[model samples]
Every structure is written in structure tokens, then in C-alpha cells.
Target chain A: MTKTSAGKPFPWHILFFLGPGLLIYFSVSVYPLLDTLRLSFFHESSDGSLAFAGLANFTKLLFDVVWSEPFWNATWNNLVFFFIHMLVQNPIGLLLAVLLSSPKLRLSGTYRTLIFMPTMLSVVIIGFVWQLLLSPLWGITENFMWNLGLEDYFDAWLGKESSALVTLAFISVWQFVGIPMMLIYAALLSIPDELSDASVVDGANPWQAFFYIKLPLILPTIGMVSILTFVANFNAFELVYTIKGALAGPNYSTDIMGTLFYRTFFGFQLQEGSLTMGAAVATLMFLVILLGVALYLFFFQRRIKRFQL
Target chain B: MKNTQMQKATKTIATLAAGFALASTSFSAFSADKLVIESWRAEDTKIWSDIIIPAFNKSNPDIEVVFAPVPTSSYDSALNAKLKAGTAGDLITCRPFDVSLSLYNKGNLTSLNDLPGLASFSDVARSAWITDDGKNTFCLPMASVIHGYIYNKEIFKELKLEVPKTESDFFKVLATIKSESRYTPLVMGTADQWEAATMGYQNFGPNYWKGEQGRKNVISGQEKLSDSQYVKTFEHLAKWAPYMGRSYQSQKYSDSQNLFTLGRGAIYPAGSWEINGFNAQADFEFGAFYPPVPEGQDTCYISDHTDIAMGLNANSKNKKSAKVFLNWMASSEFAELYSNQLPGFFSLSKHAIDLKDPVAQEFLSWRGQCKQTIRNSYQILSRGEPNLENVLWNTSVGVLNGTMTPKEAADKTQASLVNWYKPQQ
Candidate 1:
């Protein structure tokens, strides 16, 4: 009656609140991403001049023997690294989460805190710590294994080309398994007790109840965890860098996209930095990540729907 | 009463304004003379801050020196970022060889060819810091690092062995040590990729590659790394691998040094920079020797490349003060102080202080006796390629692991070089 419903002006206060955040987001994240994408098209001349080279950098990265060899090796290694996490890390995490979520489990709070402690620490620090523990020179692990009468099983896992990447992946997984554990734990806790009771009352055993009632509910979280693992694994650098160095040594067996990106971008030893090529690598990494996320959303994520509990 | 209050307030305000104006003027005048140097060696922070700057101030009291120490791992990238952003220090510690050349070509460095200090350095010392054209001196050559093996004197004495001068003799010594089983024959921390290349191949590469002449040949496309000489270097490295102890690949750079200092190993291949650390840490006496050459070669070629060189930032507002610092750095007094502070860094200054440490003195004796002091292969290799250090080191790793033959390793390295150089041709 007083025209109050039709007369309210646009919320300038909301714009004011969002403006600074949007500006920061654009500058810090979006702008740099776009700029990197743009830089991938150019090449740095010997005299330090930048000239447009279009897709030449990309082409060279994929086709040229020198660049392509390392590129493919890193790509394949990165995928292997991601798969290791998927196969080993996630299952261990899910088990720990399930066990911790049990009603009969004592000291669950302390266990959760203790288990998550590694994730709280820096990855570089963890990598170094593991390196020392596993070092053949110091014989710390060897001594422990000797005490256990398993000395013959001890090997320089970090040194072997076949074992280095997997060993590093395990180290990474050990440090980060806590993340998925907490995530899955939260998802499990959100499941109502009544649902479990309902399944049990219907003559389902504990295992059957868990399988039919709880597993279906936690599927969505597992999907999310999978996506997160994919992203983190592909983007990882520090662990390999700290343990294996820039060359990702033992003949570059442990090299991942992040280290390759770093080597190309900053140069190592005798190689000069090539900004354009580095940008191209970074752009590819971005596209790979995007493709992964899109596939998750359209395929796996869509199939796993969240149900109200 | 209001008028009197107003007068009093205005007087107080004027006094405060005058005080602030004077304070700011003096501050600007003081800050204007300050010079900042960005150095990669964090270990030198104390020497620079506590002694060097104070000593420099004695000569030029008006100028202040600020030491900005960056860790070696990220120094080049950090410096590059600073230079690109126009925020680089007045004086910059240039990384040796290609990194310095790259910076100079980018016009980030100022030429110091006209500096009077340039004349004092010997031709060999001056050559380490000059441009490819040999006309422009982009940085002031400070000290040259000698690369060789640092051996436990006690172990050598106890084992009844002398410093081996020939390759066969070296192998025989290693064999004796291995047979004794009391210590590792050679302590190599190949887990760190640079160590294998730095202490192993690069140190020995010159002996076979033929020093400056080999460099010229490679650069001129007349020779490749796969050539018999370089291939033999890898083969020799492979032969030496068994003596490096089981799980040598898990040994870090520090681990090798630790093993050497603790008398766990007979020989540790390292550079001159290890002298101070070894002296401080080792309970046993240690001596340095060049890596052995072939059976007939009389002299072992040591890597005598410039260790740390100082360059003036082209965009620096305090270039005059920076040049003063560089001039002081090039002086005999400065060299004496530097050598005394960090022994074993052989100063390029004409009046370098005689190193008093027995180990350093031993290294100096080699420098005097050696027929040729060649640049390390890492220093001489082309920067246009994938790092030769990485290629050589990776290939060396393959040899060590028995995954690839020495010939294959050499061929792979040559292929990398050809891949890089062929495009340019």
C-alpha cells in the first residue's frame, strides 16, 4: 500500500562488501592465470626479447625429442603418483575413518589428533624427515629393521630408480592420508544412528549394515576426496624436490609436472630459464587439472548424489 | 584570551613542523648514501655484516653497506625476479658462468671493464668473469674455487698410502681401502644429483676433455660429449662407484662430508669451500688433492673457476657507492680479510693472503704445480641446452645403477648436446 515492495533500491552495501574481495580475487588468481595463458604463446629470444611464437612452444613440448621425452616421462610419473595415492592412501584413510567413527572405539579424539598431526606439518619438512629416516648412510631404518629381524628386507628404497617414485608417493600419502581420513570421518559422523538401527533391525549384520547403509551415504565424500587427491597429486612438487632435487634424480625417475615446470621456469645447473616454455607447461598443467575436475563433475560426481540423512 | 590561545597553539604547531622537517631531511640524507648487496652465500652474512662492512666504512665513512643474504637454492630465481621488478640491490652477487652471462645479456648488470680494480687480476682470474667477446668485464672477479678430493690424512697414513697421482694408482688406493674394509674408499652422495656431477664428473671431466681446448672444440661443434674422452670419464666414474659404499645414492652431500670428517671414508671429492668446514669439524687431519688423471698425464687438472663475483646492478640508484664496494672487494686488504675469514677461497687479487691452513696450503701448492687449471665442465657448457650437469649426472646415475652402459650414457649426453646445438647451427 505504501509502495515499499516496489521501491527498494539495489543493495549498494552488498556491492561495497563484495567489491574488495572480487578485486583481490581477480588480481591474485584470475589475472595471473590469464597472463600465464597469454605468455605460453610467446618465446624469449636469446637477447631477452619476447616474440609471439603462437603454438610453437606447445608443439615443441609435445613433439621435440628432448622436451617431449621429459614431458611424457613426467606426465606418466605424475599419473602413477596419483594412482598410488588413489589405490593405497584413500583405502587406508577410509579404513581409519570408519574405525575411528565406531561407537566402541576409545581415545578416538586423541587418535584423530595424533593421526592428523603429519598433515598439519609442512610437506617439505615431512619429506626431509622421511629422507633421514630412510637414509642408508645413517642406518636408522636399517637398525630398526635389524631389531625386528627384518634387516634383509631393508633396502635403499629412496635411491633405487624403480622404488624412488613409489617410495616418495608413499611418503606423500603417509603425510596426507590424514586429510581424507578427517573428511571421510566427518561424512561418516553425519550419517544418522537411526539408519544403522533400521538396517540392523531388518536383520542385517554389522558388516552388511555398514555396506548397505553407510557406504552409499559416504560415496559422495569419496568422490570429493578422489578429486582433491587428483588435484593435489598433479600439482605436487615440494616432496619430490626436497627428497630427489630438481633433476628428480636416479635418472629423473621421480620427476613430476611440478618439478618439470620449476626446472623449465627457473633453470637448473646449465639450462637457462625459458619463460614462454615454462608458461606453456603451466598452462598444460592447468588444462589437465580442469579436465580432471570436469570429468569428476560430469561423470563420477553426478552419479554419486548426496542424500539427506 | 582566545587570541592569546590561538598564538600559543600556532607557535607550538610551527615548532613541531620544523622538528619533523629537520628529522626527515637528515633521514633522507643518511639513507641516500646506503648501499645494499644481495649475496647468495648465507654463510658469508656474518663476515659481511660484522667485518667487511665496518672495514669498508673505515675507508668511506659516508657510505653505509647493507648485506642482503639470499639462500643459494633460490638465489638466481630471486635475483631474476628482483631485477625484472626493478628492485634489485645496488650490488649483486652474480652466480658464476652461464647465470652471470644470462643476466649480463639481459642488461641487468653493468660492465666494469673500465674499473681500475680489473687491471689487478691476472689473465686467468679475469677470464673467469669476462664476456664471451672478452671485451666486457661484467663483474669483479673475487675468489676462485679449486675442485678436488679431500682425504683423511690419518686414514691415508694409517693405511700406508700416499696421495695417488695417476688414475691407476687412484684405483689401486681405492682397492686397498676397500680390501681393508675399515672405511669407505670413496664417499659420494650421489642422491643429491649435483654432487655426482660437481665432485665426480665435472672435477674429472677436464682431465680427459682437454680443458680449454675441449671447451672450444665442443662449442665449435668439432667434438661431442659422447667422444671417447668424455665417455671414458663416465666409464671411470662407473668403475669408482663400487668403492662409494652400498646405497651411495641415499647419501646426501652433507652425509658424505660427515662421513669424511668422521674418518668413515678415505676420500671425499669436494671443492675448496669445504676447507673451513672440515677444519672446524674433523677430529682427524685432512688434506686436498686433485682428482687423478690418466696413467701418463703428469698433472691433474683442477677446476679453478671464479667462485663468487660481484656485479653492479644497472638500474641501481647507488651505483657510485656500489662501485666503491666493488673496488674495495678487489683490493688486497679485502682479499686478505676474506681469505682469513673463509680460508681456502683462493683470492684472485694480486696480493692474496697466503693461506695458513695446511689443507689450503696443500691446495695452493697444487695450483702452483699443475700444468693447467681448467674451468669446470658445468661452467663451460652451453646454457641454451637442457643443463649439461643434469644430462651428465643423470647419465652417470644410469652407469652407477648399471641400467645403461658408459657408451650409452655418453651417447645420450651427446644426443642432448646435439639437440641443443644443432638447432642453433
Candidate 2:
């Protein structure tokens, strides 16, 4: 083996295969991330040019009243946003996946597609659709509530300060639940059918088989989906932007990290955007995402066994 | 076969790469007179290309001008990057006040004080593009959108209401409409927030604060936002809460526009820009009224806010042709055409334009009648954190939504201002 290794040249084919993709990734993704991290350490000086100001940008972002208030608000909002997704989106996705993977389910393909249709649609279109349906002036939602004899309970959910963020979170979940559903469904399908059959033959019911066998098998996938949802929720910007605008108004009730980062990066209305401040926000977002991912990979992944099915 | 396929794939990619490299080398060869104007009015792309550019070509046939507009939302940052890269256009469309001022301060814009026909604009018309000391004007003022209430003539006629002349009468009309009519009394929303501040607060607040004097006083720290006039303005906004249709807290700007144009609304607190769209959409006749003055106040003020202008890019190579185009923009012929083409956007040039659109003419007539003021939070007040304009948008929405009192709204805005603004500090 040593003689063969010494005789053979290095694997040129592997380099040839990986070179383009790696080069593209480095240029587009990796470089921008590093550059943004570098930018967080610099600031706009008096002459309107970038100057190195080591940690001043991060310090100002975390401690300055004007900056810190919004930063903390957005960070807190983003946590709530993720929690809502983990609580609502994942459970629903898992339930849907389980039901679809059940025996004798008719039109399962159609059901899957119908449930996943919103995920395939543009967020701008969905936001517009939801905004119209919920608008107080539009009255379609109100009229529906009135017809259902729930008119007294009806309120403009999107417009109310108390409900706006929750409403937006639900909208995002509605649009993206299919992703987790699809992942979980594939995991469910990949589990060996004979294992469930063997359990059933031993007088175990379908529910018992699912709980003991199928559930354990899909735990790793569930963990992966949770991490993905966490990252996506923290990075979410478009739906909020489409509906609430950069201000995320009704007194910024729905101002998430994404919108905050955007506003800091690209000044909205009268607020002049600061590149350094934006980079600092981005760096914080990166750290939060990284911490979440690290916790999941180190703790959750290790704890959850990937059963060889 | 697989090995041969790989070889073919590599060759194809190499060929494509070479093609792309060649294609990206130069955008196009252009003549010396080819001048590009960078603007944020992407919505006006058609108007610029079809109407404005064509007209300019008729006068100066040798010059080629392109109306290159990015989306309005990203204009400032895009302009900053382009200017830094030394790749911006010959002409730049100036946003009102601080945005353009900063651009000029950064040496991205050149002073157009010597541009011919600039002398024709009144001080108020030139106010938005001029520097604070009132010595240098970097841009030739293009258009100003005046604020007022665009009311349904049919609703007024049906409700037996005359055009309101004072604050009491305005409320009285709203009450009459609320009691007798199915039509919404005030068609504006807090959801988008800007409408409440722009069409509601700025429309009505100017008279309370006494226009330019009050705006200037607030800026120089002679007056505070929490002062009586400003609180009184918020109080007036608080009063508007009831008159606004049900669920206005959730109503968006587009929703209000749609509601009004659908004839479900009696009044739309408006900027002149809405005139063109309203005219297109509303089947019924509509007329505009300036914000009714408070009972004791005598002198009326209107937010004839200068909204758009054109400036010379500092690094532009073809200065002569660009200035000629700008000169034309400030001319009587251009003013008439511009005012006629876009009815609500009244030209700022001094030439008395024979406006073709009667509604626009009605709005234009207010220039002679009322003292002009821009939005209060613009100019220098919004340069810092907790931007005063955005603050007003929030506070104004809060007041209208009944979540914040007049005093709270005023204090909130004032606190944000004092936190950073040195003058206010």
C-alpha cells in the first residue's frame, strides 16, 4: 500500500471536480461572511471613509441606548419568533408527516402537494394575500368571522401591536412548514417497513410501533429540522419587510433581527444606514445562529441516536 | 464514453467562460453627449422615457439622456455606493433635505447655484435643495407635493356639506358623514404609518405650528416638539381617531387609497401625488381643500413640500449637456408639460403655468393663498438615531390608534430628538 501510494500521483481528478464549486462558494458566501466580520471592526470616520476602530462598532451596538434598545428588542423578538416556529410549525409538520405516512391514506400525494403549495409560492405574494385577507378595511376576514358568529372576537390581527409579531410568525410558519414536513416525511418513509411489521406481528399496535420504532428512527431528522428552523427564523426578513415595511410599525411591534439588520444596513426613510452598525448586527446574528447550531450539533445530535434502519 | 463526456463538458465550460469574459468587458460604446441621470423614481420609468426624455431630445437632438432609476427604497445607499465607486450618472435626482445635503457634503453633488433659470424659483421652492446657511443651492428644485384633503364631491353634495373653512367645520362635516352616511369620514391608515404622519399630521399640523417659522424654530431649539403647538397638533390627530373608519389601526396606505378610490370614503387626506391616481380610479368627481385652520388662528399654512429635484454629479464628464438638460427642467415649457403630465406634482419653477388639469390647478392656486412649509421632521432634525421623521410616523400612528395620548406622543418624539440632536440637547 505504501509503495502504491508513493507510485501514484495526487488525486488530480478530485481537485478538478471540487475546484469550481469551492471557488464559487469562497467568492460568494465565505468571502462575504469574512468581509462582514472584518467590517464590524471598522467604522465610518469623519471623512466618510472606512477606518479601523477595533470593537468600537460592536461596543456601540451592544451598549449605546439608541442602538442597544433596538438590538435587544430585535434579538428578543427573534427568539420568540424561533420559539413560535419550534412550537407550532414543527409539531404540525410532524403530525402531518405521521398521518401521511400512515397506512391506507388515500390521495396522500395530493394532500402532501396541497399542504406544501404555500412553501413553493413567493413570500411577497403570500404576504400580500394574507394582508388583504386580514385588512380591516378589506373586511373579508371580518365578514367571514361574522358569518361564523365569531364577529365579536375579530380584530385586525396584522395591525394590532399586541398581535402583529405573533401574526407575522404564524404567516412565516404557514409558508415554510412544508420544508420540515417533507424532511420528516422522507425520514419516516426511509424507516424499514419490516421493523414495523415485526412489531405488529408481536401484537403491538401501529401507535406502539410508531412510538418505539419510527419515532426513534426520525429523531435525528427532527433535530436537524429544528436547527434549520432556528437558523431560518433568525434570518427571516422578507415576509416582515413585505407586510410591515422597514419600520415594522404599530410602534415597531414586529421588528425582528432581520428587519433591524436591514434598517441598519440600508437606512429606512429618515434614518441614515451605517455600514459598521449593520455589520455588527450581522455579526451578532451570526454568533446567535452559530451558538444555536453548536448547541444542537454537540448536545442534541450526540444525545439523539441515528439508528441504522 | 464517460471520459469523453467529461472532456466535452470541460471544453464547453471553457468556451462559456471566455464568452462571458468578453461580454462583460464593456457595457457599450457611447457618444460623448450620452448622459445618464440616476434617479429613484423607478415608477416614473415610463414617464421619463416616453414623455420627458423625448421632449428633451426635441430641443437638444444631439444629446442622449437615459433616465436610470433604481427602486425608491434603495436609492440613497445605491447612490452612495455608485458615487464611491466613481460610477454614478451625470445627473442625480435629489431626495428632499438631509439625504441630498449629506450627498453634497460628501462632494458627491456639485453646486448648481449658477445654473440658468434657477433664479426663477421662489425661496420656498428652492428651500429643500439649498444649504442651511441659505447660501448654496446644490440642486434645481423640480417638484413639490402639496398636502390637503381630497374630498368626494358627491359625498359632500349628498351630506349637504359645504367645503369646510375652519377646524370646527371640518369636524362638523366628519360628524355629519359619520352619522348620516355609510361612507368613511376619513380614509387614511396607521398600518403603513407614513400616511398618518404625511397626510394627517403634516397636512393639519403646519397651521398649528405656523409653517416655516415654527419648523425653523424647532430646528434652532427656540421651540421644542413637546411645546404646546406640537402637542396641540397631536391632540388634533387624536381627534381624527374617531373620524377614521373602523379598524383604521390595521388599515394600510394602499388599503386607504383603495377604499377612497372605491368611493367608500368621503375624504382622503392627500399629497398632490395622489391626484393622478385618484383621477384615474375614482368614477365620481373629487375636489381638494387645504387643511382647515384652528378656530383662533388666522394665518393659514400648507405643507407644499418640495419632493424631488435634479443635481449635477460632481464627477460627471459631460457637464455642459447635463446642465442644459437641468436648465430645461427649470424652464416654463418643461414646467407646463411636467405639471400637465403629472398633475399632482406641481412644478417649483416661477413661471405661471397654464395647468391643463383643473384639479391640479385648484391645488396649485393654494400657492398664492397659504404660507408654505415642508414636513416638520425633515431638514436637519432626522440626521441622528431615532430619526425624527420615523419617530413622528410612529407617534402619529400611536396617537391616531388611541394607544398614545397627545402629550405622550409629543414627549416620545421630543425625547428621541433631545437624545441625539445637539440643538435639542
Candidate 3:
């Protein structure tokens, strides 16, 4: 009667309940992550054998002229890719969400579905469709412009080095706008109608009410969307690879971190592949994403919680 | 009751295990001596399964040859992984140069020097799969593709232009076609980048580089990319921009193909591999001409690039049947069948086979008329970083796009070579 609960028989069911989940998590997720970290520490030697070389791989990736040039170029392109998503994609999505969420809006469901359609389609198909439409060889875009009397404005946007990356970024944004739109739309719908309606009774205009009331309520959703965009943009590879190829050409203008990682790891046609180098690049990508998520958690995420409805 | 259920489960498991053992024995017995040939040429699956394997089987009924192909683009990586895992095919299809050489060095490929049928192929054909010392040939050379322009015969007749033999004559023809205004003068593009190098540079640059002489010189550091001949090659390639189709900067390989096939273009800078596709698609009659030589050059060279070859896998279980199949691949019968079936891919063997495809025959005729050599960068030079082939592709694209002057292009190419290649360094 006096025995403490801690001295009682241990709960064997606890281990039983968690066994499968822990086992799978350790094998699939934790094992690969730790293994990648281990592999990154090793470097390929002259004889094609991988030896434990401490930080040699990282140093070569960051400082070796041949390796560093493409690495930095890709990192910079990835930043631009993310920035385009932030500046163009998120705002347009927000605007569409607000418009769709208006009370008694006609065909709001149809508009929402139509806008969200591109996100569900495969990136490769979207890239090809956009490439074909913009192609001067097909003259589809040029012909459409001709009918509208704006034919003079059409240019080979994808072909030019100056415009290739930006064009790709915009195409990517077009395909993914639905993601933010749906998220924000759902967030806006969750805001009780009475909240905005009360602001309307206070004699504030629709835009003013949106800014003062509904916007702040959706700030947390927007924060999540931004972080999601950051991760997706940096991880992007397929669209550019499908369109411009592995070289990311017109002088590697469209080259991004993912493509560089691919070319380094799998080796382009003439360049022999090195698995260690590819693993090192992959480790760097993981760190970049980790650092980004950490920053959001420590800074933006905390600020976001204060505005949560 | 519990003991009886466990006994029943054990009985079922034992029965299933026995059944599987029986099935596997019968399966292996039915398909004895099966050999799998792994290749990158998935498009040629029909030809291999329908024609080539059957002929071999007709003579040797005991052996089964399975044609297994993966997509061309992923072949190298897939093959490497499979080889490592000991799951690759018995007969491995080899790419022309460094790839197979590496395989030999890695002991993944067995030396084929002792294979009897190799004598029919010349030194140049075998050169692709040979060791650096020229002692061991690892792969049997299967075929080569000759680099040249496939032209619309109707368009040439319409413009009253003869096939241009020299660079100046070629330009005069381009000018005439341009002035005519109905058709594109040159159907080529920079979007894919390789066409600029392969079709534009290597297509016309052979005559300038002097083929094997210039190629070997570059490898040995006897010559440099900035040399007069190399620079001149870029100059001719750069000039091609003006003659190319509209929006040629972005025009893709498929677009160029459609333009030429639709009879909208006059001359297609082409590899002879396109003979079959053009024959099937083009409504108008067409023919090919070797890359026009520059002014005052009496001798001509063509990039008779050795493309496809086959090698014995070191780890193959069915090596006996695989060797038999390889020997048949080298025979005159296989050569004739392969050449006739795949028109553009000329058999690398010295056997004089009759070819029916008019365009292919025209290409084959160049073998007797011109000195034949492979692409310069395929060998030792491309083994290092800033890979010469990749560099050539971009620089050639830059030149075509007017982003780099011929001198700039030449300098850039040489700079990359000097960075890593010990001979150039």
C-alpha cells in the first residue's frame, strides 16, 4: 500500500506502441541523414578510392576555383529563384485569395479550382507546355500577339541569357501560385465573417478593413507560405533541367544549386561522375535548408505567433 | 488447438517453398544459356529483337539472346550502378571512347584482343575501344555515323544550286537561298548546344583541323586550340549564324528537324544518323553532302565518328554464349543485315556490303573519297575538368549566338584545356 508508482511494474506497452514507428524513423530518416554527413567528410583520392579526409571536401567545394565558381553561381541563382517567388508569386496569390474569399462572390469555387490547377500538374509537363507556347518556331505566342496587335513585343525570352533565368522563375511562379493561393484562401475562410463585418460597421472601407483586420489575422499563414516557398525554390531542379538541360545553358545562366549538384554528382556526358562530390553538394543543400528553417523559427516564426487569431 | 494451427501454417509454408523450387528449376531448364545484351539504343530494340537475335538463333538453337535496352541519356549512370551491383547484362554495349576505356581499366570489361572477328575492322574503327598503348581492344566496333549536311533535293533544284564543295561556294549557295526568301538557308540551332558543336563545328571543322593529325596533335600538346586552324574553325562556325533560321538562338533540335522535313529549309547540317528519319518524314527527295571544305584546301577529312560498340562483361554468367553472339556481330552477315536495317548507322567492319538507302549510300561513298577520323575531343583530352566536349559545345554556341568572337571562343576553349590537361598545361 505504501509502494510509490515509480516502483510499480514498468509499462511494457509503451515500448510495444512505439517499436515500429521508431524503428522505421531511425532507418529511413535518421540513418540517411547521418550517412550523408559521414560521406561528406570523405573525399575521392587520385586512385578513385574514397578516403576519410576531414573537411577537405567542404574546402574544395567552397574554395577550389573550378568547383567554387559553379557552386557560388548556383547559390546566387537559387536566391534569385526564391526572391522571385516571394515578390511575385506570394502577393498575386494573396490578392487572388482575398478576391475569392469575398462574401457572395460569383463562381468563387470555379475561380479557385482553375487557379489551383497548375500546381497539381507535373512540373515537366508545365515546362514543356510553356516552352512550346513561347517558342518562335511554333509562332503560337507571336501569332496570339499579332492578333492582339502586340506582335512587336514578342521576343525569344527563354533563349537569351539575360532573360532565361527570370523567364524560368516566372514560369515556376505561374505553376506554383496555386499553393499559396489555396493556403491563404483557407486561412481567410477560417476568419469568422463577423470579424471583417464588424470592421465594415465601424465605417472602414473594404480595403481599409482588410488591412486593419483580416490581413493581420492571416500573417501566420503568410509566414508559413514564405518558408515553404524558400524551401521549394532552393530544391527546384526539374523545370530548368527539362527546359534548358543540365548545362543550364545560354552560358549556364539558368544554372541553380540543384542542377549543379546533379552535374557534379551524376557527371554530365563528358564529365565523369564522382559520388563523394555529389554527396558533399547534397550535404550543403541540407545545411542551407536547415539554416533557413532555423532563421525562420528564431525570428519570423516567433513574430508570426503574436498575430495568430 | 494452437499447436495444430501452427503445424498447419508450417505445412503450407513448406509446400510453397517446394513449389517455388520446382518452378525455378523448370524455368531455368526451359531457357538454357540465356544471354542479355544491355544497350543505350532503346530505339533499335525492334531491329535487335525482330531481326538480329533471330538470325543468330537460327544457327545456334541452344542459346537465347535477349536485347535489353535502357534510354540513351541514363545509360552510363544505370550501367555503372548495375555493374557495381553485379546485375548488368552479359554483353555490355560500349560508347566509343573514354567510357569503355575506363571500364577496361576498372576490370569491368574483359579484353577482346583474342576475339577472331575483330580483324575485319581497321585500326581507326578499333581505336575507339583500344587501350592507350594500343595493345588491347575491349569492345567490338559496331558502327559509325558520318557527319555531313542532308539537303532538300527539291529546294536545291528549285534554287538551281549545286552541292557546294568549298566554304565560299557554300556561302554563295546560302546567299542565293536567302535572296530567294522562300526557304531557310541553314537549319540549325543553339538551344540544345550540341548541334552548334557537332553539326556546326565538327561538321565543317574536320577539313580545317586535318582530322586525325590535328586531333592527335592537340592531345600530345603539339598544337593548341588558339592555333590558326582552330581559330579558323570557329570563324567559319560563327559565320553560320547569319545563314541559320529565324530565332535560331532558341530553335531546338526538334524544331530544326521539323523545318527541314516540312521542306521549309534548304540545307540541314546533319549527321548521317538522320537518314532514316528524313527518308520516312520528308515528302521531297533529299541527299547529303560532306561539310564544305575551306578555300584552297585540296584534301578533305570527314568525322567518321565511331558511335556504337559491344564488349564482354567481366562478371557475365553466360560468357560462352555471349562470345558466340559477339562473333556473329562481327561476321559479314550481321554487318549486311545491320547496315540495311539501320541505314544511317554504317557497319564499322571492312566488309563491302550493298546499301539500298540512297542517302546512306551517298554518305558511305565519302568513306572512299575522303580521309576519315573520329571527333577530336572523344579521347584523352576530355578526361579532365572543364571537359573539352562540354566546353566545345558552349563555345560553339557562344560563337553562333554572337556572344563570343571567334578569337574569344578560341581563347576560352584553350584556357579550359590548359587548366587541367597536363599536355596543354
DockQ, per model, reads 0.53, 0.65, 0.54
Q: Rank the candidates by TM-score, best first.
A: 3, 2, 1
Interface RMSD for every prediction, one decimal?
1.7, 1.9, 2.0
Per-residue CA lDDT of model 1 for B255-345, tens digit only, reads 8888888889999888888898887789988887887889888656777767788999998888888888788888888988888778778
Q: What TM-score does chain A of each model score against the native chain A?
A: 0.96, 0.96, 0.93
In model 1, what are the clashing residue pairs, if there are any? none
**Native-contact recovery for every candidate?**
0.61, 0.68, 0.48
Off by over 4 Å in 3: A1-23, A45-48, A307-309, B1-33
Estimate, for each residue in A85-199, the C-alpha lDDT of model 2 and write its tens digit.
Answer: 9999999999999999887899999999999999999999999999988877765888998999999998988888999999999999899999999999999999888999899
Best by DockQ: 2
Tell me candidate 3's fraction of native contacts, as a decimal between 0 and 1: 0.48
Report the Cα lDDT for residue A281, model 3. 94
Model 3, range B1-425, lDDT digits (tens) per residue?
Answer: 99999999999999999999999999877655999889988878998999988999999988988999997666887787788678898999999889788888878899988888888899978989999899999999999999999999999998789999998999999999999867999999888888999898888888988998999899999999999999999999888898897888789888999999999999999998888778778999999999888888888899999999999999887777888888999999999999998899999899989999988999989989999888888888888877888899989999989988999999989998998998888
Error of 1 at B373 (Å): 3.8
lDDT of each: 0.85, 0.89, 0.89
Lowest lDDT 10-residue stretch of candidate 1 chain B = B371-380
